[model samples]
Target chain A: MKVPNILKKTVPVAVGLVVLGYLTLYFVINQTPQWIPENLTRLARQADLLENPEAKRCFECHKEIYAAWKKSRHAIAWVSETYIEDSENRSKEKCLPCHIPRQVKNGEKPQPRLDHRDDGIYCVPCHVIDGKMHGPYDLFSPPHPTQKNLQYRESKFCGSCHEKTFEEWKIAGVEDTCQSCHMARTESRLVQKPVLSWLHSKKQVGDHSFPHGEITQEDLAVTGEISGKEFIVTLLNQKIPHRVPTADNGDPRLYLYVRFLDDSGQEVDRFKEILAPQQDTALLYGKEARFQYPLTAPVRKVEISLQYKPAWSKDKSEWRQLSYPVTGDSG
Target chain B: MRTSLINSLLFTLMLFLIPLQLQAKDMVVKAPPESLGKYYPPESKEPKWIQQMHKMSGNLGGVFVNLREKDWDNLDKNADQFVESYKEASEMVPEWEEYFDLKAAKEFAAAAKTHDGEKIGKAVGAVGKTCGKCHADNSISVWTRFHWPSFHKIKITDPIEEKELDFGKYMGLLSGTFKGVTVNFKEGQYDRSQKALRAFKSRFMELKSTCSKCHTTDDVKLFYVGENVAQAFDGLQKELTAEKPNPGNFWKNVGILGKQGCKNCHLTHRSYAMIQERWEEK
Candidate 1:
């Protein structure tokens, strides 16, 4: 173990100079007039003082996720007229808890937000909690502290609010969760910030849109046959895991509309059967609902269509319709 | 010296057996096989599994009754039927074959013919022990899985607003209105109290309409959601208006609603409905 004398003296001198230079730069940068570019990401200017940032603040970095969330039913949970009226203008304490909910934890219903009543079920309540941002990832972000929480990837996390649907899902006895269906995953960088996001590689991120995975004619299958003086049409809810037109507090509807035309192709009779959950009238998961309408007139053709109105929707035009062509003629 | 040698041998035997007992005890309880669903509904046209179970129990009961009456001819028939059903059942579900003890059945038959009470009892007990072992592990899982109909799937119509609500929300409204009657009356808001009572009455009565959703049989609908509950609600309305109303009258109606309407129905329905959601065939 022979020591090199020249190395020791030069090493100390270089280290001293480096320290002195760093001190000078730190003093100069903090004290002097600095012209930072206006286009610099918010990562550079962390001057926003609100302890709890709005969902819009997240838009600066998470533009796509922010946009999707803004368009979600959760965004209008607080401001929706239906919610307002149902809650008796927020006078009902029981109804207000879920609308402007605080942080969600696994299996526990969230408490009402104390500070941000207008935000609804927004970003801060879901992702931000306990002075740090939480997600289903273990990654670095200099702007804020991060903690990995696996509950974000589970159905029980959403069970905090969508309790009834969650229970229905559990009874379905399927492994696929609320998140698995609704917040489907895609590969992309979670952040849109310039240099900060570049440090991270592309990874699986959930779609925050919370899409219901729109039901269509593909979901509800209609088949029929005319038996003498009777027309029997069966609507099978083939693909959906839950009852069609389902809701917790709201009355969503499914209309099985039947139109019959005479031998001359003039409309003869029309029949409408409305179905809803908890009433046993709704189309069940993987089950068939049979409707038999009598052919009173000299029959010709049969037209069958399934229409759905979500609980939140008000206008009839907003109701979604799925129609099947009436090919055969009774005449 | 002979006694000491025997004691040591027994100690060695006990030592060897303890770990074996612990290993058996530590086996985790899992749901019965998904293959059981093969003989159940949505798979088979008839419930072959339940039919097999019923057949076995019926023959076993016949064997007991015939043995008690000392009817040798029918005893032989019932015993033969029991063994036939037992063997058939063993072949029905492969996973359950381990629980079916044919040796125990033969032993019971041999004992039953001997015409000794103690021997017959022991033999029957042994055969029953086989069933008990199988049932102890599987009966609740099977009952929870197959017997209960899903009640939570349906919605309730709120008669006051003429709107349909989810099960949980409807329950909340039901509870809220019931409490409202009490709270409004306490606050001296007689008008609000009367309004709440009216809403409560309508909601209570509207609950009857939902019974037909599940109960097609008039008897089933009549049992809980029938005339008695309807009378209870009506009695509460009249009691509230009485000149000297009993303070306990409201709670009496509450008790009737709680016992017959909520508690009894929940006992019959809720536990299985919830457990079915949790239990898995895996």
Candidate 2:
């Protein structure tokens, strides 16, 4: 068989030129000064370029993914008040490893950020690593990306900062990690990465924007009921721990108090029960939390309220209650 | 010359038959299935209950399951709905923790058949309570017998947090076994490809020790690892019983280690990487 003139003479040269062009482009993209977007790069550079340089650089190349990451807990992991307090002033090595290990690991001598402490966890700490490339999720899978092993995509990476929560869940027989609940998705964290296959598929169905927004009352349903003398209140554990008012330590709980008022609105009969441990917290999900009051001189209406904590009485005489009024089912 | 050729042929046949005869004589047959019952008990039993409390709980459970299903459509509706669901189950179920597993299996199966995420969430939430109930009763045995296997099979409908343990040494020990197996496969001391295939097959069983710890078979194929591992077991058992083994007591010792160590299967990772790796298909 005779070879075509184009195939015989120019094919190898053309292939070589194509590969050389691809390499040149890859290097140029990496080295060039990227025009980072404001949403993607939260850092202002502030005259002196000291704090979170890797993040600054990351924003330059991956403006889109950077925007998504900037909105993530990882981006703000170091800035979160909860994480700061949990870290106990960043004195503990455990906290720093999870929150901002890369800076220390890479010998980047982190100078404190202005207006906000940069002691909390950051992005590159978990994501940037050197090893045989596994997919971000698959631990046992070999031949990982050329850049790094993708083990950071596992729940264990988050386990570093969220140890207490993780352990409590284990003790509680819960098998979920932080992303399982916090991300908008019910099962996974819905982590927004540029290369995620699901996101690619999701783009086909809807917008390419990663779902990042605060959940509001519109995102939840609140209802209350009354049966006989007992006021039944139900709140869905929609997107949180079964318990309301997510407290880390102590008994993170809600108080269910019911008050019966006559026509003139005098407190006739009252009952309060703390929805403590072993109490069905799911009534908040769909079931009814029943609180009882004795049948008195003909009750006009039932008023049910949920308090985060019990009434605090500093002095013997005066007391302040942080109780919030709840809308209840009538009659 | 013909006689000499016949004798030579007969000698070669005799040489082949000698090993076959020796191997047949040396083989040790397993005892009948009746004897196996002494080692493994049937995995079905009715648990004890708290009479009056059980009746109250049974009644309350019935009421809650009904109300819970109604509002499951509007999951994001009514914060009080969630509160009440938790209240009834948490307060009433402790007295009857022992009786929750079968009840849970039945409920979860029913819930799985429903195509709604909200209803499924509520049902899953209900299942979590049952887990708490069982956990409260017999922490060790409940975990060993039911929780670990079931959890390794559960498909978590949402992402959630896990707790950390201070047991670094214990974790290291567990990680060592995984590393050892991996190394052995790499070195080809064992059939590397077969082991990888076995590991992949037993992946669900491995997962049963992980996230599926809280789920049921009907809910998700979380324990498909169990099915995978079952395939590898026959071969592994043959190797375990083989003479002159490289890791002589590795299989028996690891089985014991697994029983004692919950964290081996119930790992606490910071991300979904480990789980994704375990469950993700090639």
Candidate number of the best TM-score? 1
Give every collision pair in model 1. Answer: A278-B154, A278-B155, A279-B155
TM-score of each: 0.46, 0.30
Query: What RMSD does each model have against the real structure?
Result: 23.7, 32.2
True contacts kept of each: 0.00, 0.00
- Predicted structure with the largest lDDT when compared to the true one: 1
Q: Please provide, for model 1 over A170-196, each residue's C-alpha lDDT reduced to its tens digit, 9 standing for 90 to 100.
A: 766667888888899999888888755
Q: List the candidate 2 regions with Cα displacement exceeding 4 Å.
A: A1-53, A72-74, A79-119, A131-157, A164-229, A232-259, A266-298, A305-331, B1-282
Sliding window of 10 residues with minimal summed lDDT for model 1 chain A: A29-38
Q: Whole-model lDDT, candidate 1?
A: 0.68
Stretches of candidate 1 off by over 4 Å are: A1-51, A278-280, A317-331, B1-282
Give one digit per residue, the lDDT tens place, for model 2 in B1-282. 544443443344334323333434343322222321222222111121223334433433443344335444333332333334434434443544343444443464355345343444455445445544343333433223322222222221100111222233324433554555646744656644333333332222333322322232222332233333343454454553355443544455345434333333345331233333343332
